[model samples]
Target: MRMLINVPETVVADGLRGLAAAHPDLTVDVENRVIVRRDAPVAGQVALVSGGGSGHEPLHGGFVGPGMLSAACPGEVFTSPVPDQMARAAAAVDSGAGVLFIVKNYTGDVLNFDMAAELAEDEGVQVAKVLVNDDVAVTDSLYTAGRRGTGATLFVEKIAGAAAAEGQPLERVESIGRQVNENSRSFGVALSACTTPAKGSPTFELPDGELELGIGIHGEPGRERRPMMTSGEIADFAVNAIVEDMPPRNPVLALVNGMGATPLLELYGFNAEVQRALRERGVAVARTLVGNYVTSLDMAGASVTLCQADEELLRLWDAPVKTPALRWGM
Candidate 1:
């Protein structure tokens, strides 16, 4: 594997150090492998915590800041964080209000976060969890029992984090997070596979002129492989899948997320086509984001996430957010 790194084992640690250096507002607990906002445990406010494997940068970590996550725990590439890391981060970031764990619907993530919640509660810290299962690709996968969480994870974090920052109680914040997940749906297509730093090889093989539809972020096999088609045709397929699953209820937030290697220009082109497709189905794109928010290492492709929005959800989404990956109106 031709990766720019001192060694495979220390990639996660080195990346953490780099993140800390880039963002002075963030603090890294190298020993426990948790990243926390410098001004954590904001008094009388519920704290938001989320984490997963390390490869999906600017994800659980980059989203940590005001109006987002208070703490993020990253595990090794495509691996779930241990309970000890989550417990320590929760304890450190928990104010008197409580802590809400935003967990993706993966087997390892679910199990680890559950254990950490128990550990935190045992130590007299109030904790709750909201599982994100917005991927509409499949009902079960190699890593999850139900729908796998994907781009909608970010929507939940931003909306729920805003509620928490507004000093909402733990139950209210958790309910908002859950509602976001319920109202969102996603579908992804992959033109190429990602190479993990440790393995130094593409996670999966895809021949030229072929595309993997409904792929997962961890490089898991998608629903099926089909011959490469026109962008318009592909966009129709992706948008239709999400619409069929949850049928856009008008005033929806549509996110066209590149899977790492796709260029920004191509993503914009895809976004335009996606908007056209959605309109054909009578869905209005109230707000749209086209970029690399959630990624799969260096994979080349994109995913579409649509969340049915109301006045409240749209207001929270537009609220000021200051984070490494996503920042605005701050």
Candidate 2:
């Protein structure tokens, strides 16, 4: 019930205004709410475009820069961007080398991005798409949409963007992106629900001592709910689920991501627990990251993602990246 700012009916527009003002170097299309590189359509290089809802800050938009996304469309909170917006972004970023759409495995996102790609192709722009479905918590492959794409998206954007920036062909970049998606897994737990500004209250109410397991990024109900436990116990359950689902012996690029409200101290503690769990299982932790990467508004929770790393993936991980959210190697 307590939040700042008037609830703008259109969350996407309000958020885009703030983001554009914050990063003048990134050009914003107010009509479409798409954030693109200040100088877009870089000649002779494949352009990378990704987008989703607005609440997950520093995601698609925060990732726009030299070595990441060329453009990102922003939707309303927990809502998919319309196809027209995506089509515009695609057209704006398209260069002679073609374009790539990095889509998360959500029903709306897939449908909208697919429509945009078709529209782009109709305009004679070459386009390739990669779908990321890396969450291990969901099952029923026949009926369900398989796993929900979660924290591994950050890795996908960074690595795939690097590939495009380095002038790799669209096919090669999309292929490598798929490889990254297949090798990654994520699981999340929620301690408290988030309030959508329009809704004016928390999406769900969790009693003081309960937690929801296997949560998705949109404050959706998780697989199970139970009394809250110690951070170590929570870490074991999450890390074990992911590790068991994937090959245990592979080196992993690990991420402990806070949903939003969780503090850095708690995230670090959870990361330590994750490291312990991985070590106990004899899994090699090649690199580690801890922060609020992908969030569900101000929800109190955390998700862990592990991407099996090889020499090629390691090389991509080491590639220089410059973005509002992640920057290294000037």
Candidate 3:
């Protein structure tokens, strides 16, 4: 309830306005909350579109640029964007080459994006979809709903965007996206809950000196809660979960992502701990990225993502990217 804002109801709109102003190379559809690269469709390249709830900034929207997503639809805070919004984004970004939808494995996201894909197909636009379910905390198999997609979605965006930017066909880009999802795993812990602007209060209450382990991005109840532990212990818990699920046989791309309120210093400290844990497990770290790449509003938490990398995956990882949030080798 203690937030600073002139008009709370206008938070999403205001934030989008600011984002559009800050990045003129990107165009914002204020009505639909869809962000598209100013020069969209990129001619013959496969158009990439990914989206979800809004609070996780620098995600689908911040990632719209030359080597990332072609368009991103922002939903209401912590809620999935509706089907119409996604359909509009797909239509706007589709070129003759086709479009790819990178959907996280959230119930709302899956349902809405699926509807959009069906609508897009009816419009005669070729579309391919990949569902990311890389969170190891949730069990997955033929019967289960599959793991919740967390930090790995960012990796999918970066690598898949690179493939599409390289003029890969829609099928190839979709394949790359699926491959990334299949190889990646993530786990998270929350020290504190986040407050949604719309709700104007914390989503959940965590007592002092306690934390929630195996937390999902939507503030969903985690697997367990226990007294606060050292950074190393927390890192071990998360890394061990991922390592247990995905054995250390291949080189890995590591991402230590902050879930909003955690500072850079804390994230780096946690990253060091994660690196130590990986070293102990004999896992070779091919690349490490630490930042607020994927977040859960102001939640004081972090998630670790490991993408088991082969030579081809590593090559794609090194491919040039020019998104507003993730820019390298422009």
Candidate 4:
């Protein structure tokens, strides 16, 4: 894997510096590993904070800005950020309206965010938390006690951040964020294993003719492996698992997310199959986003996340948002 990083030890910091240079609106704290909206501590508005491992670019960090995350703490690659990092973010962004921590269900993230909440509360910052365990691919994985968080983290952050931006109180923001999590489900397929900067090689050995179904972001073991399938075949397998687990009750917000290395051309093709599969299952889509929002670094695959949305949720989802990676309705 010929990654452009200078060295394994400096990859996260290097990326943070680049992010800061690119988005002057965000106050990227390279030393502390926290990213904050420059206009944060917005008076009378609840603050939204979320984070996870660093390899998943444009995730917690890139999503920081208006109508999304007020702050984000980035951990080392495939590692959880320390409690101090998250606590720093909470304190920096909290304007007395409280902070809502959108945590993924990974064991390390869960534990560290839990401690960060306590740390932030000790500093007189009220905090609430919502867990995103939307990956229906597996009940338990190497990284999580429950289903691992994946694409739906984007949905939770965007929807809840919109509510928070409108001055919704902590309780209300927490309610909507959790509702997004509960109403969403994700399933991923891996065409190739991801490579870590430190390892300088693929994290897992995925042979040439096989693909992992229900693959996790960190390359954790999934349901099973099978002979490589076509785009349509992959869509049927993934969509079947998702709808079978939780049939959509309303029009859904669909996320056809790439697993880092998959190109936009391939993602759009896969999305067509996904849409066909959903229609076959009688599911309606209110909105569809196709790209690498939540990702596994350099993994050649994609995940489909369906978020069942009510009218209110759709409105929030359509709200204006400005961020490094995703922006619309400015």
List TM-scores for all candidates, in order: 0.99, 0.97, 0.96, 0.99
lDDT of 1 by residue, 1-330 (tens): 658899889999999999999999999987789999999989988999999998887788999999999999999999999998999989989997999999999999999999999999999999989999999888899889999999999999999999998999999999999999999999999999999988998998999899999999989989899999777888999998998888667799888999999999999998888988998999998899888988988899999999998999999999999999999999
Model 3 off-target regions past 4 Å?
Answer: 139-144
Ranking 2 against 4 by lDDT, winner: 4
- Clash count for candidate 1 is 0
What is the per-residue lDDT of model 3 for residues 1-330, given as tens digits with 9 covering 90 to 100?
Answer: 666655767777888888898999899998778899999877889999999988888887999998889999998887899988878988898888999999988878899999999998899889899999988876642222668888999889988888998899999999999999999999999999998877777888999899999888877778789999999999899989998888877799999999999999999999999999999989999999999988988899999999998888788889888777898988
Q: List runs of model 1 lying over 4 Å from the truth.
A: none
- Deviating ranges (above 4 Å) for candidate 4: none
Q: Kindly list the per-residue Cα lDDT of model 2 for residues 196-266, writing each as its tens digit.
A: 88888888888999999988887777888999889999999998889778867579999899999999999
* Tens digits of per-residue lDDT for model 4, 1-330: 678879899999999999999999999999999999999999999999999998898898989999999999999999999999999999999999999999999999999999999999999999999999999899987888988989999999999999999999999999999999999999999999999998888988999999999999998888999999999999999999999999779799999999999999999999999999999889999999999989888999999999999999999999999999889999
TM-score between candidate 2 and the true structure: 0.97
What is the lDDT, from 0 to 100, of the residue 179 in candidate 3?
Answer: 93
- Kindly report the root-mean-square deviation of model 2 from the true structure over all alpha carbons: 1.7
Compute the lDDT for candidate 3. Answer: 0.88
Model 1 root-mean-square deviation: 0.8
